[model samples]
Target: MTGRFITLEGGDGAGKTTQAALLTDWLEASGRTVVRTREPGGTDLGQRIREMVLHERGHVAPRAEALLYAADRAHHVETVVRPALERGEVVLQDRYIDSSVAYQGVARGLGADRIRSVSEWAADGLAPDLTVLLDLDVTVGRARVAAARGDTFDRLESEAAAFHETVRGAFLDAAAAEPARFLVVDASAPAEDVQRAVRTAVGALVGIPAPDPSAS
Candidate 1:
């Protein structure tokens, strides 16, 4: 039997990565082999693509940037993610296709259908079993991102709250369309509360009992 794929997603500063780590550790303690990875960095090629997507190297056209993200995701799935999943190892991803759909497709003014087509080609149709979306007010998200020590602002970071409204709406739309696969998390709460929600969501997805310890 193949393992389940669970992904964390949201606008910048939604704390998806931090939540992903907590979930990974919790799931690992349950004796399930867990593989934690992220888009645009899971494979060597993907890492290069990540730099390109983040505009760390050169200026990338918006459409080209979207395609590059798709390309990196393709390699990531084919090389690192799927194999572990086939071995029944729980796969925890920091971000997934919806990030592109929201950031590029909606916020960048590209159509979601076009983005989906490109992404589907890239991922070979391997969608995650569950997606956790950390929802927060755009202003709040930007503020949190700015306060983080290791966080690097991306191209999408400069956009004002209005742009983020589109992205957030897109995320909510995706979640509404696939209620069984997407969980909207209110990220404005304390960090531990958000992590608790993630743990519960993941536990429900894989039929594994979550650790009962109170969030620290």
Candidate 2:
């Protein structure tokens, strides 16, 4: 039996990690095997790449950054995601091809088509069965990120406001283009509300009731 692939995407501080954890907990409670993972740092090698792309203090050329992300994705899918799916498990992932398209392709001035093409080739064209887009205003997102990070922004997070706005638009455009694969949630809502929406959407995929919020 094939498994489900689900991804969470949004600007920084969109509460993806929290929602992913809640979903994983509820799914496991429901008797399903779940593989919770993320791009950039999902594997050992990916951790190193994540450091370079996100934490390193130097400017990486936009194309180089995109290629690094694609490299991590290629290895992540082949080694981690594919094996989990082949085992008939739910792969709950944080970020995927769309992040590359938005951050590197559109926001960085590279063509989205070009970056998406490269990313698709890297992952052998594996697409998520469901992609939850946590839509949030860039300004609000940045403020949340700053509060959580104590003003310590990562390389991408340190980008100008206009860059983040571009990234937000790109994500929305992508969701609009592929509504069948996307569930857009207003992330500005309370955290529990957003998670409830995510669980409702994901439960429909796995044939489970959205677990009670108090239980989660």
Indicate which candidate wins on TM-score.
2
- Best of the candidates, lDDT: 2
Clashing pairs in 1: none
**Per-structure clash totals for the candidates:** 0, 0
lDDT of 1 by residue, 1-216 (tens): 379998888887888878888877888877778898998688889888877777574567889989889889888998888899899899999888998899888888888989988998888988989999889888888888888844567766766788888888899899999999998989999888888778877887777776466745
Candidate 1 residue spans exceeding 4 A from truth: 150-152, 210-216
Cα error, residue 81 of model 1, in Å, equals 1.0
Runs of candidate 2 exceeding 4 Å displacement: 211-216
lDDT of 2 by residue, 27-90 (tens): 9988999999999999999999999999999879988999999999999999999999999999
Pairing residues by index, what is the TM-score of model 1?
Answer: 0.92
**Cα RMSD, model 2:** 1.5
- Candidate 1 overall Cα lDDT vs. reference? 0.84
What lDDT does candidate 1 reach at residue 57? Answer: 49
